[model samples]
Target: MHSVQNTLYVMTPNAYAHLDNATVRIEVERETKLRVPLHHIGALVCFGNVLVSPALMHRLADEGKSLVLLDNSGRFKARLEGPVSGNILLRQAQHRAALDTEFALTAARAMVAGKLRNSRSVLQRGARESADPGEAETLTSAADALAASLRAVPGAADLDTLRGIEGEAARGYFAALNLVVKPQARQSFALDGRTRRPPRDRFNALISFLYSMLMNDCRSAAESVGLDPQLGFLHAVRPGRAALALDLQEEFRSVFADRLALTLINRGQINAKDFDEREGGAVMLNDQGRRQVVTAWQERKQEEITHPLSENKMPLGLLPFVQARIFARTLRGDMQGYLPYLAK
Candidate 1:
């Protein structure tokens, strides 16, 4: 099992990160603000105008840690890492599998099934906990619809058909998600379907930020296990896109990112005042909001869960790595097929 390590996020604008022997030091306005031992860090993620010294970048690469850059709104910009240490044979197998329609379809079906099943779990749990009879009925109806989608996964004739099923299921899921927010907080955090890029509403903005971090983890997981991040079974291949990472992200979106976003909103950890409305009607979390989310994200990762397959307790943060290894095994023919992480 891969142990969960810390990801140091540099969110302060104009903050400078440099190497100080075995430590990573952060300075602002020419004064040291924080220092963390390099060994404790698995990755360094910088949001917005954070600066990283060249020496620190080199060290990070040499140590096999990743450095990710994102805009203030958490849009991906770039990633830096060490030389490819992944097995060429594993990647070759991944490529060959991508070209095999049967293999690709099977993998895609598994991924979609995992996503729909996890999403249904979320809706059903919300339905059970909802105090309002009408809200509970709405959630239950959505959950039943997702169950129907899950049933259709095996019968999907092609990738396009499978994608259609997933897309429709997602629409209903998001529509029902609006009811999950506490009634008192609904005015502030109500989700208006699912919008991205600039995320028109507050809920969309919060989840988009969480999704960016999840994408980074998924990409890193694929790279660590010698899988090709660009070639994927479900998502279409495109230049500059980590298709495999996006593929892996599907199963975790509801169980990880969406659930956390709801928790923060319902528990009042995040509020309307935590976001900013830019001139163009774009909504985003302010610095203070980002800090609150980051702290919650870190804490959430530390919570332990037992794997449905391995039955071993592991940190939630390691799910991506575990699933990536499972994917590699399937590509290598060691496993019959890809088994997604089913959240219990």
Candidate 2:
């Protein structure tokens, strides 16, 4: 499976029969179609409108593929096999072990700071392509501020410190973005904004969408490793919060999502028509917009990049792989730390 490029995505409003083609086919639909390849599938995500065939239900229990179902609101409804059946005592110990101050702080800092720095890295790259020199300077400055915050994170005592750094970094990043997108009155991004019609102004909308995709990718990685998604290190343990998913997503929000968003904009892969402010107080991507985003995300998954810690070859698209490895090590007691993945 490692050697195989076996990620298949299907998004169809119309019904279609399942083909006996790939090992895993992620079907996201409003209703059910044919029998799902549960044994073959590695993961599945359905957003609101989906009806599962009886065979697929049975396969879920037997094959135990990474099955995750979400409601219309995108909250996790059901998971096929997310819990461990190992010795209760060992599992309890692992859970408690995870709460130690050292482990907690290390993981949280790495994720938060990684995300902030990656965002800076992406913005700087985008700045290079900005049409205006002033805009580029602002972006570079934002990137620098974010970098400084990231460097000051190792000694952060609590989540509040992490949050402060994150906030400051975002402020700088957004300040620069406003300049890049100012000429386009229809486009803008602000740190302080509500999910209104055009949930985010053109610029912010794209960034927010990119952020969502990044979070999903990180969640997928954490789920694959069988860790409790709610027991997070950085974010507070709120009810129904995918705390661990939030934690994992921290490192990726910028690394994957921001990079993709900029590429789409600079390459002319997406435009204003891709967004819709149809409803009041909320904005969203049109079907075409979602399609384009997913295509770019999938393309990102296929690209390879270097690992800063391992100093070995890994996928640029393998943010999940990198994350899963971190979790696996933490669980096995092989490593006493969780390090954020960084570029060489």
Candidate 3:
């Protein structure tokens, strides 16, 4: 049996990396050499001041490997690859399928349904954990109706109809948020429109920060796979918004973001202590909480998942591959409809 490959995680305050005589060198106070077999490296997640050599960059370019960079504050700064083949037909195919009434509706429904289902499950789990069965049943019904509505929408012509359906689906999920989180006082996100500086409350700040990172990954991956990162059926395509990424992220809202948020709250891994109340109605996470959330998120990305279409196990890392495959299937006319990935 082949061993699973480990993603190389370079965490440091400051460092320089370059190729020294064909060997990859990671230099700080002292130099360490890593003769990384290209196949052995699944991805690169760099935390703070880690440098990449031009030679190493070229090598990754040749192999088409993934590089995810995180700043000290846990902000995702850049994604290096665009993953375009420079073929006009391919680009046209992506745009056509993305905008097609039937295809877009099919893709949108699957994803929207997946998100609704997960939302219900999260509510149920949180309810059960808190010893509340009433909450669970409420969530179960929400899941049922959301699924029904997804199938019910026959032929959505534009983004509005799709969003109308999503609105219906969301009612069931949000109804349970108050039940899950205790209501000593209501916390506000106070987004003067950007997440920056000393966060108002550690918990809310952690959620936004982590969510932003996930959003970047989803958008970058969708773009690399040749999907229009800006056009999403379930989400409105506004200025600077990555709707397609939002669309692809539906199945993961529960599996990735929401679950992490709940876990952090439940495990007492993070709490009110980690947050601060800013004068401008903003909330933020302290340094310790920031580290905790980013670490957990990285581990979550490394979690292995089974591909719904391929029936082969892969990491959440391959969600992009999965996205590209389904879109390609629609273009090639192989699939009657595309289904978003839902874990059993």
Candidate 4:
């Protein structure tokens, strides 16, 4: 299995990257700011306006590392990788399963089960922490709704039925997400529901940014295991969509991103002032806000958690890679079935 390692993020707008004596050198305003050995990094993620020298890019490819480019607000722009890794047979198995209705349904059920279970956990935690009786009741009810959805997954007869169950659980989860925010901060950070394609609120913007980060991590994990990240059973194939990566992302969206976003807002590390409203009523994080969120995100990735299935403690950053490896094993017919990551 591929191991998880450090992911270098360059969020500064003017930062330039190049190779200097087998190390990645970062410079801004013509002054060297940081230097990291290439061997220590798993990926180099650069945000808006960061320039990567050809020499550095070639060296990273040679070292089997990834170079992911994102806009300032954490939108995925592009990704550069070395030669594809992993066994060809594994990918062939993945493709065959993707086109099989039974295989797709099984895999989708595992993924959506993980999502609902984690979403329920988030709501349960919120209910426990909430002082307001009404808010606590609402959160508990949502958690129950998610639990019902989880029970319904195995009974889903078709793709559309499974999607309907997933959508209902998501709506119930998001409705309770507002209670995750502290009462005093609700006016500034109320989350009505999930929104994308230019999020309409600060809460949605934060969720989008976090989802983008998770997507990149999932893509890297899939590539590391030699799986085609673009071909997935849960998500339909579409032009330029990383379907497999997205399918993997569903499990972690609640446990990782949603939890962190709540921590940031409830703790007052992020506030309304950190967002900017653009034309057409779109909302997004400003530069300072992005930096704060990214730094916190990196630190959060370092935190360790125990895997329920493997029963091993590992860094949070390794979760996606571990799940990908397990999924690959299932596709290869080495395992009986896929086991989604379950939060305790």
- On TM-score, the leading prediction is 1
Runs off by more than 4 Å, candidate 4? 1-4
Residue 338 in candidate 2 has what lDDT?
Answer: 72
Residue pairs clashing in model 2 are: 30-49, 30-50, 196-281, 196-282, 197-282, 199-283, 304-316, 305-316
Per-residue C-alpha lDDT of model 3 across residues 249-308, encoded as one tens digit per residue: 777766577678766675666766666566886565655555667677776777888776
lDDT of each: 0.92, 0.61, 0.63, 0.89
Per-residue C-alpha lDDT of model 4 across residues 94-191, encoded as one tens digit per residue: 99988889988999999999999988999999999889999899999889889989999999998889989999889878877998899889899877
Which stretches of model 1 miss by more than 4 angstroms?
Answer: 1-4
lDDT of 1 at 158: 100
Model 2, residue 202: C-alpha shift (Å)? 3.9
Top candidate when judged by lDDT against the true structure: 1
For candidate 1, list the clashing residue pairs, or say none: none
**Which scores greater on TM-score, model 2 or model 3?**
2
Clash count of each predicted structure? 0, 8, 11, 0
